[model samples]
Target chain A: MLDAHLRLSSLAHLGLAARSIEEAGDAGIALGEVPRRVALTLRGDGEDAAFLDAVGRALGTAPPLTANTVASLEDVVILWLGPDEWLVNAPAAREDALQALRSALGDLHHAVADVTESRTVLRLSGASARDLLAQGCSLDFHPSVFQPGMCAGSHLALTHVTIHQIAEDPVYEIHVHRSFADYLWRWLEAASEPYGLAVVTG
Target chain B: MLLITCPWCGVREEHEFACGGEAHIVRPLDSHTLDDAEWADYVFMRRNPKGVQYERWVHNDGCRRWFNMARHTVSHEILAIYKVGEPKPEFEG
Candidate 1:
């Protein structure tokens, strides 16, 4: 039997030592990993009223229909991947939402897979967060083009990442697969080095 | 880089998509009945015109669905993109 206290982290190899630099300028950029978030890939027909109602009942909100947009109900944030597909991010400690989703969606022609263990959530926030990402990402990061609540899947540097704009200060949440976490972290650190990068871990 | 618009997802970067050769190439209904020349035409012959051409592309990184695209092979400009089973859009250019 696995020991309850023996916890393993996807980014454990990189270690949790926080690194920062003192500068006279604004908080240049802070990067950190979000721990213990339940991730699920939800697939269903968005046009079906029954399907939408069931999903809403499970997550306390309907799956967003807008392209590349996100719908949040408390701690759970549903990111629209496609017309009929969404990625649900919720608090990891709660299993009630997952159970509710399974029971409510059992009869529908839908799919719900727990992807919590497969993805690593990385948060980037600062005055230069947008500019830092703009260096590698091709998408237009201007406020007029990409605002809060919008999410997109695009290649950042050398790998694919899903970036979500969380706030006006340009706090961005990047979700990448566990295998690419280290590479992405190192790459991001180097990219933001000019702006004085800081690493924070929990 | 070309910006290919997915039928389901909106316009995304060219890297997210994978081009699947010529589009609208209907396979022979009965292959056994066809002669060698007809088989060769069906298998090898494709319209690789200089201007507007029809082709298939898949959004591999995003929605992961195959869709048809009408583009200019010379300029690499996407003229139109439509879903499967839908009629091809008229080529305006």
Candidate 2:
């Protein structure tokens, strides 16, 4: 039997120790990995009241119907991927969230899948975080446009990433495919070189 | 780069979308009854208009929804954007 505890993050081989690093009095950006987050892809008719109600009961909030928006309650966050598709995220080892959704949605012509291993989450924060992301992304990063609570799926450095802005401090949680985790990490590090990059861990 | 507006996700970079060729190309209901040339025309033929052309595009990177767009082939200006099933809007070149 494979030990779940022995599972490692995609960036594990990089040996990036999470330590606070200060540079020239202040660091421009702080990068860290939020490993092992449970992700589930949920698909259902957004216009159906019963479907929405079931999902709401399961996660404590109805999935956001607006495009590129997010809804969260406690540790469960739901991102609208499309008109009828959503991505549900919760803390690590929260497999119960999936079961709760499956049971709640019982034969309601809906689909819920556990996609935890498909992608890894990385938290990028600090004042210069948006600037660093804007270097390669085409989306306008103006505060009024891409504010907290908003999320988008766009290409960053030619890699597809789903970015969720969780704070007014410009803290962003970037979700990228596990296979591209190393490449994105190296890219972020190189990009942050201009603005002192600090790699930290929780 | 073309700034295509996704009906659901708003405006995004053109790279995030994929051009799905000319729109409103309906498949023949009586395919088996049609001859070789007629079948080939249905499969291979597309209007290569120089002026306003209706085209299909999908926001593959963002919402992943297919939408219709009317564009000027010469100027590359988008005239109108509508959802999949909606009737195409009237447009002049």
Candidate 3:
């Protein structure tokens, strides 16, 4: 249970946790967290025009049809999980978007869940970013197969994650559950040891 | 590592799938009407075929959908994969 008066911070001890690699250079690899992002899981019939229209109204864009693709509109990005399921992440708060979705999808046989606190995102970038991830990840990390603006669900070091390529410089975002944050961070650091890792904090 | 193809999520590593052993075993219409021998057959008998076999598999990690697969037990080769309610495909052993 959470304390009523005590403050709660998701990445509270991350600064201290990443102390060893503080002085590492930019040429190797830089790691950081994009904390406090809004995450909402949306599920509905993708073929239903009404459902698509409702989701568009809430997100300002329709969902992606091509599997593992992302429909990014301004601050909101919707990652397609399956034919009828998507994971929407936004930089801003999700109250307005959630309300809009509820009002739009009235009485539909669908599900919308807010999972902001369920997952934590870690940004991995630099020249050796892809090479570093290729150590333990099962999916092919070559830029030719996984290009910029593409996302995929894969297993990294025995943990499930959603990997998104945001830039051609090999900047990738890994979304993992909050419960596995510490373990994944340690695993990433261990995997990136040979290349030398630099921890970036805001 | 086996690479199983999910009907919805395409080809993914076999770690994402769970084998649901044997497929399409119909239960007796009325268990009370059957004698001990017939009841024992329905409960215990299984077609552990050596060549081509029909099996049920579920994509546990990806799409989480269940589907049927025709596989060669000896060689571990997948012949065909179809949906849950799909009819058993007609193929030579």
Whole-model lDDT per candidate: 0.84, 0.90, 0.81
Candidate 3 matches the true fold with a TM-score of 0.87
Candidate 1: where is the Cα deviation over 4 Å? A1-7, A17-26, B27-44
Q: Predictions ranked by lDDT, top down? A: 2, 1, 3
TM-scores for candidates 1 onward, in order: 0.89, 0.95, 0.87
- Candidate 1 lDDT over residue span B19-92, tens digit each: 99999999989999999999999999988888899999988777678999999888888888989889988785
Docking class of 3: acceptable
Report the Cα lDDT for residue B13, model 3: 85
**Ten residues in a row with the worst lDDT in model 3 chain A?**
A1-10
Mark the regions of model 3 whose C-alpha exceeds 4 Å error after superposition.
A1-11, A16-24, B26-45
lDDT of 3 by residue, B1-93 (tens): 778878887888888778898888889889899999999998888899888999999876566678999999888899999998899996677
RMSD of 2: 1.9
- Tell me which of candidates 1 and 3 scores higher on lDDT: 1
Q: Per-residue CA lDDT of candidate 1, range A1-202, in tens?
A: 1233664567777765534333324558888888868888999899999999999988899999988899997788999888888999998676567778999987898998878778888988888898899888877899999999999888899688899999987888999998898889889889998898777652
For candidate 2, lDDT tens digit of each residue in A1-202?
1258877889888877635444323778889888678899999999999999999999899999999999999888999999999999998767799999999999898999888888899999977998999998988878989998899999999999999999988889999999999999999999999898888762
**Model 2 residue pairs with clashes:** A18-A201
TM-score of chain B of each: 0.92, 0.95, 0.90
